[model samples]
Target: MSQRQRLWQRLTEAGIAPGCHQALLDTGRLQPNTLKLSHWVQAETALWLDGQLLPSVPPRRYWAYHKPVGIDCNVRPDDPQSIAALLQQLPPGVFAVGRLDKDSCGLLLLSNDGPFAQRLLHPTQQHQKTYRVDVDKTVTETMLQQLRLGMRYQAGASWIEARPCLATLSAPNQLELTLTEGKNRQIRYMCKQLGLKVTLLQRTHIGQLYLPALSAGQLLELQPQQVILAAQQP
Candidate 1:
């Protein structure tokens, strides 16, 4: 294992926010200049800045939450409707892996492992995410084919191309779609382009991670291996 990482990067990996570190330095609680490059952290070294001892790196945690509609994914301490409000008991630096828009709900991952989250969310990873959608009108074979073929739409100054890995009509008005790329409200926009109104949208899967039968507002701690396996899935 490498014993060297930039001070800010090390703090971030250990679940400390960069802003907090800067604040400590600014307040004279930390003296970065006093530490030499050779003083980089090793596995057994305890971290100290100035006269204050920093806590050891917290154990990395992973969680699966059945995010409910109306809960914003963004972390806003002052907003009761935000995901942060629901995760008050979580460790200080754990954050939602990606996002579930306020109008959509279902499986969401929260973790303190930044690299793991990146592997799952980055577009180049091509991780699969499945959604069960309910539209205002009946979904036909033609519409399914169209969705599979992909669509392009202009959003403000940019054009977005959205295509599903799989698109099938689960019911007269329900569709099960799997996508490898996530764009902001892509499903709703795609449906709208086809003259369909979306009534409900719930994400059921991310890579190999499935939403268990947890009720809305329920959260479950997940093994880190489970997350790793999910991201490794083809």
Candidate 2:
């Protein structure tokens, strides 16, 4: 989408009240700023609104949130457990990265920076996400090897396509599984395919970033610089 198109869609989604959008176009309210200068527009452009200039995108923010079970990943205003309400004290447009299912819980990265998220999430990056899972059946060597072999399983209409992960017996009926892919409930689907029912699932790591001393619903901001530096170290 062009810078102009993106701005129009943003305003439309924000629910322009008692006004025609043509007024915005005619009145010079759409400020493209540096959006025209680059293919990636970060911290550069936003629609000028009201009587004054709406601020350009805020400085990027990154937070590692310990998301609890039952919270939806999206920022649905009506859902109490929506991430928007969960992180309401934070600035707007901050959204969760590395989504966890409503039943899954653990280290969910939240950031206002889209490019940074894309850097980590694009399938080719192969960033590792570690999950601790409790299962109803024994976690055996056979199961581990199958997952290591990247067993292809069909989950309903979609395929659970993931890179082979190292699955080890962490404890009886439990496994520590790490994957470079973040498919929806991929671990649970893997467990089910192996005849194990997932009793609990929690992500503990994303790349080099980890949750530290955070309780459920707690948000701890990280210095974006340090996070990138940490990823480069070792």
Candidate 3:
């Protein structure tokens, strides 16, 4: 194994959230004076924080869950209908990377590694999210072109353009759309603006990771590499 890597990179690779690691260093708990960014992480090297030797990073966990409708992505302990309440078996520390509204259902990635989540969800990354949508009426070519080119929406005091990388009529009343941005209910909003009613909105892919053949409300643990690889795909 290559033994040369920056401290932050090592921490991220070890499944430590970059922000969390920096917090410890900033608080004088990580002994920044003794450690340098150029320091290498080795099997025999010990990491100390707050005078206590830190253990090797815990094994990273990743899961692809088929979020069922009615399950809120950001689950609060007080919300009985949240994903946390519906799926009580998720390992502690794991959280949904992004969100699926209470009415939408499909693939949702969960992970304990904050850096990994950041990489996938950061707006700058522009990871693609694909959805299969069913509308109340037949979608026209003009509407598809409008979606592909872009559409404007009111944002408080301003208007913002929302565009899809790919939009096609999967069926007379169904559409397959891929987007790189995550705005608030973007797909639904886009459809509403186009004078269409969305009857069903299901996310089928996030980057290259697809919703496996799992039943609604089901969870499947995946190797961390699977997600990383998917995000790297075109």
User: Which candidate has the top score in TM-score?
Assistant: 1
Off by over 4 Å in 2: 1-39, 42-52, 224-226, 229-234
Model 3: per-residue Cα lDDT over 1-234, one tens digit each: 623445765555444555587676767777544666556565446667668775554556788899989888776767888876743465445668899988999999887665677778888888889999999999999999889888896655666798556998889999999998999888888888888989999999988887899999888888766776657646
In the predicted model 1, the residue pairs found to clash are none
lDDT of 2 by residue, 105-220 (tens): 88888776656676778788877778899999887788899999898777888776657887888898988888888777788888888898999999887766666689987877
RMSD to the true structure for each prediction, in A, is 3.7, 5.2, 4.7
TM-score of 2: 0.79
Q: Model 1: per-residue lDDT, tens digit, 1-234?
A: 734444664566555665587776567666444554324555345566667666665566898899999999987879999997876678766778999899999999888765677678888888898999999998888888888988776666777888555898888999999998888988888888788999999999888788978999899888767776567665
lDDT winner, 2 or 3: 3
Candidate ranking under lDDT, highest first, comes to 1, 3, 2
- Model 2 Cα displacement at 56 (Å)? 2.8
TM-score of each: 0.83, 0.79, 0.76
lDDT (0 to 1) per candidate: 0.78, 0.70, 0.77
Clash count per candidate: 0, 0, 0
